[model samples]
Target: MYWEDFLHVTAAAVENTVSSKRVDQFKEALGFHGIPAGHVPPTFVRTFSFGDIKGLTWPDAGMIHAEQEYDYYRPLVPEETLFCSQRIDKVVRKTGRSGEMAFIYLTQTGKDSAEQTVFISRRVLVWKAAGQRSEGVPE
Candidate 1:
């Protein structure tokens, strides 16, 4: 569909819990010591953020992650439960040598049991027009 139609749309909230084991494993994998500043492991951002968008229909042509950023409002503790939701902030279309492309801007936010925001992750996804080929991008 049209990019404009998806703007401002929000997905359902999903609940997740921080696992100490996973956090420790992530830190060990990256050679980091104890959770610094009480922040959740970086990996948690991606692992827990996508649940809200699972019901959305994505283009079959595939997509590329163009950019991503995270904003932390407060430190998270192990075993803390969070309710996360995703929203489509904006969608823009442009033409390039490859073909028409859509830039989808999304924000995923997490809130703690007390409903205080813990973190927000923003991402930009590039979806190429169907049947178009780009160098380094498999058709």
Candidate 2:
């Protein structure tokens, strides 16, 4: 996708409160044996999920999680109501031996009740044959 188009592709803001009990359950489900540390796991952001943007939908099957990175400015504590804002950061198209693919880079920022950024997550989603456009085709 063009840079201009990518700039406009983004998900609406999503918000949720961080529940301590949910964190405990998540740790147990993953076989993490330990007492509560009060600091949420980097992946805890997954507990608050959101769907695709109106016109940007991932394939129901065959989509791949290409990469992920998380930067924590401060620890996320339990019982704190947090807000998650998501957006499409970048888009790149490449062709490999397998086939054509597009890498959709997405970012989610977790903020405290005060609207301070606590953490930022960058993830790339790879979709096969999703970026190709035939001649005379219009997006």
Candidate 3:
């Protein structure tokens, strides 16, 4: 249901980190004001790095049903650094109700170009099975 990298990418590369103009484009896309007066929205940041992805599939299909939870290293995160993240790691399988599930965890670390960790992000992915056919809590 979620891409693990989202956690990492979200925390790492926010709108300001990307571009203010792009942020507006992102806001338009997300139905937001693109204003920085408030907290930086994670969803917009994720979208900036990785375009619109309705779902995850093969090649990146490893993250199906993830249980892992990630957090930004608060101490390192407040610095505000550039971020880059990828699929990183994953675990895939089939479940009784969900059919196929993979748990993928992504790690992202931001640096100040001096190669120091300015921020860190970890994310989990819960890949929904193909042919699920319906949108309800799998029984």
* Model 2, span 20-74: residue lDDT tens: 8898888888777875668677788888864345544445565689889999998
All models: lDDT?
0.74, 0.71, 0.44
- Model 1, runs deviating above 4 Å: 31-39, 53-55, 59-61, 130-139
Error of 1 at 130 (Å): 5.5
The deviation in Å at residue 36 for candidate 2 is 2.9
Top candidate when judged by TM-score against the true structure: 2
Q: What is the per-residue lDDT of model 1 for residues 61-82, given as tens digits with 9 covering 90 to 100?
A: 5688999998998767888889
Task: Name the TM-score of candidate 3.
Answer: 0.46
| Candidate achieving the largest lDDT | 1
TM-score of 2: 0.81
User: Clash number for every model?
Assistant: 0, 0, 7
Q: Which of candidates 1 and 2 reaches a greater TM-score? A: 2
Per-residue lDDT over 1-139 for candidate 3, one digit per residue giving the tens place of the 0 to 100 score: 4334332233323222545555556667777764554344454435435222224333443234343333444332222445443444544344657466645555544444455544444566565653343342221
**Could you tell me which residue pairs clash in candidate 1?**
none
